[model samples]
Target: MTTRFDPRKALLALSAPVLAILVAVIVTSLILVVAGDPVGEVWSTILSVPRPRVVVSIINASIVYYISAVAVAIGFRMNLFNIGVDGQYRIAAFAAAVVAGEGWLPGPLNILLGLLVAMLAGGIWAGIAGLLKVYRGVSEVISTIMLNAIATILVAFLLRKVAFRTEGSNIISTTPLPEDSRVPGMAIIPDVSREVYGLLFLAVVVGFFYWFILGKTRFGFDLRATGRSETAAVASGVKVKRMVLMSMVLSGVVAGLVGMPLLFGQDHAYGSTFQPGLGFAGIAIALLGRNHPIGIIFAALLWGFLEQQSNALQITAGVSDRLVLIIQGVIVLSVVIAYEVIRRANVRFEQRKVAQALEEQESMTKEGAPA
Candidate 1:
């Protein structure tokens, strides 16, 4: 039997983002007015985007954000909260940088080794939370949060004790990766001075795999089933503990990529100046995207655009860049509320449709028997 198209459900899904954006825009405009900023001017500056350089920067930034968000999304799909992504990627990058700096192999081999080190470091870090959850009955949420703090301390200690190296101007950083280990940037935009990240393709590949594995694989079915109802999944003979562990590790593997674009394409080393808070940002992005790989890409790009706009806002409107933070926070909150509301409405609509169909069938049966 063929299933009919669900326009109402489709509309409801689309409305979540649209309505949330509308609410955020309205609220942000009011705040801008109170702060003596011209809403129109601010938006104009943001939308103008200035130059090809700025566009390239946004795309590059979005690639990193995409990796981070997808990592968080993997955990989200399995009802696991891997808050330790921050720590996972930091340590992973540091270790990978240290290994890559050795430069003991051919260019391709060196790059592969660096990536392997990153994945191992991140997976091991995330596995700690998974182990605690499966064997010790600890909540992954609590364990992961604690692990984040521990990771910060551990990274600092390692940086000082082992990986410390002074670079130009006495900047503290891990040993810089050799040229052979670095991923070259792509000159995707013709005549643009800025080069797009080579690792952007990696993010796209990860997204494709995420969508395929989750939608078309048996493990994906078990993972989704367990997420929906653990008891039912257990009764169906799905291995809950193993699934949980696998999901967390898979999330960490992706989290390892979060630092690669910046590491290979720009920084070439892990340093004190490395960007932090991306893991937290990933959580917000994942929620905004509803944990779908394709959705996460758009969410990441939107976030990157907002971040890039902050500079324009600062220069053109003479507004504090912090205004972008307020906008982001409002957007995230509104999106969450909007999705929840839409979900409930959709559930009701489905229930009503089923009830009506049942009633119609019952009436038809009764008329045929009596007449």
Candidate 2:
């Protein structure tokens, strides 16, 4: 058998993305200087130890972005392009807020049920795309994109017609959810922000579960098999159609969870654009993390840190935050291209190994027969 890939080569391959990230950082820095801002001051602010509350917000933001990113990675692992997590998250939050507004349940239980509602709703929404792809051969990319537009429109219509129609608020949004619906928050570690600490605890749990589900479960294997080759999986008696549908549902559920931390964990009210475009960050986090859940945690933190510093860059380096946006876009695109290239190369290598093994078997058979 052909030797497996060299460990050093794999390490270097993994580091390639880090190198790109470093290069992007430098490029961003240079742009800041060119924009007439002082880089030194910006660097200082980014590295400076801040008071407890600000630190808490940063940690909270990191956890939020990281968890959402993990959700995105789940979909990507199954070969499903979940480009509409933004829509999924927003819609789920909307549903949670509606339930909260109705005051239909008690405190902690209401919060838990609201989260469940969001998770199920978002999963169902994404499942629609999965169904279309499986049954009609429609590309998920197209369907998910269309679903995003539909989600936005639906949210807008609901906000205007019912949820937050209070007097004189021009911006469309759902009304503030009742206090009882808020998820009880707590500090994770002593001396850390309570909210941040609680979120970190949740993050760890999610991370552990992510590993267990993807590594130890038969369902994960089926999903992987389907992603690698649907035809082969079907021949092996694995239900490829069901797996695809399940993948979308699972991914959507995770995306829905993203809404929970926001609605109950962070904000009690749901605004239309309260945190727009955060879901797309998952695409970057997935690529940067290489679709590994643990890696996504770090990648998400890095992106979050950069974003936190972005506003400081404006004041010190005179660079617009959009500069960060450009850099992130390029990074995501590069990761995607590189991932595709490596995947194809791996496939070719496997094919060659199979061919060589077959040839060796035939030669041995011939030699024995002649003897």
Candidate 3:
């Protein structure tokens, strides 16, 4: 019984990312046409390597997606839906920014402390949902959703009350951190045409860590086992309760880190204007990528590309960025469908194999009985 490596499953996994990019392109083109902008310019924005700034923007977007995708994928692996990543990120970003904006601490140390605080903030925020699901037997989907709202309102309130200030006499909700606290540019790669390259290293590390946690660690085993079957896992003596809580916390920490680039690297502080939908975007990325670390990287990259070119759609094709969300919805729907198809096929294959084995054993027994 020689079994060949199945490429079909790989193809299925690849389909979502490919379809997402295609949808993005098509929508952008339509927008361009409607807006009286040349669709060619929009396409060029995405494909053409112009100056280093566009390249830098591309890199920044990619890093954000990669980081956030992994954060989403962690809860997915543990079978705990952590949908409040956006709120978690927002809260954490605010925490990091406030701490760094003081200019009261040294550069490297301040940055380190800022990130640590951000992680803690995100973990605590997510822990609420975890606690609800674990002890109260509440639905995580519901709890996380509500928690997102709560987190958003709370962060908004804090910015107004606690951090209700900005540099140079502005009435902004938050103060911008000094440049010294930001991640240094990629000094090693000169002429790379991008200043915000520190995150490239972070993205690489994130990928490796993601794969390692899911593929190498014992904790990963517990998470996967629980995800595969909670009943079986509990019977096998796995601490389902603890696993759920820890996984959610860890997932939130990763989500919190997503703000580093924006809060610390770019903006130097959290702002009310910063988009929170990135967390939702992370979910789309996780699903499209099949919750695999490597798959998430490509999915994130594709999403980043779509978003970057969205501006072009508005200018060149006269399309709106809202079209990007529509395209994302289509891609997500297709990915879900693909997943179901693959799951059903695998179940059928297993059933057939078991039936064949049982029949073979019966036939052998009858023959040996001398009939």
For each candidate, how many residue pairs have backbone atoms clashing (under 3 Å)? 0, 3, 6
Question: Residue-wise lDDT of candidate 2 within 1-371, one digit each (tens)?
Answer: 56787985586467657666766667656876787766677667665665565656667777778767877888888888888788888888788778776777787677777878888888998899889988999998899888989988888787776656458866556767777666666665357535563446666766787788987899888888778887899899998888988988888887876766777666676776567776888878878888887678778877777676665656655656666686777667666666666667777888998999999999999989954
Model 1: residues with Cα > 4 Å off, grouped in runs: 1-5, 163-168
Query: What is the alpha-carbon lDDT of model 1 when measured against the actual structure?
Result: 0.88
Candidate lDDT scores, in order, read 0.88, 0.75, 0.78
Can you list the residue pairs that collide in candidate 2? 37-317, 187-194, 188-197
Scanning candidate 1 in windows of ten residues, the lowest lDDT window is 161-170
Which of the numbered candidates is closest to the native, going by highest lDDT? 1
lDDT of 3 at 26: 69
lDDT of 2 at 263: 70
Candidate 3 all-Cα RMSD: 3.8
Local accuracy of candidate 3 as per-residue lDDT tens digits, 1-371:
67687786567556656665566556656765786766665566556544556556766787888888888899998887888898888888888888778877888888888888988988998888899989999988898888889888888888887665545855565777777787866644357745765756767877798899888898888899998899999998899999999989988988888878777666666776675687888998899888887788778877876677666656655656566666667778766876777678777977998999999999999989954
In model 3, the runs with Cα more than 4 Å from the true position are 1-9, 15-52, 164-173, 187-193, 353-371
Model 1 lDDT per residue over 94-190, tens place: 8888888778788889888888999999999999999999999999889989988998888888877656556456667888878777888999888
TM-score, cand. 3 vs. native: 0.84
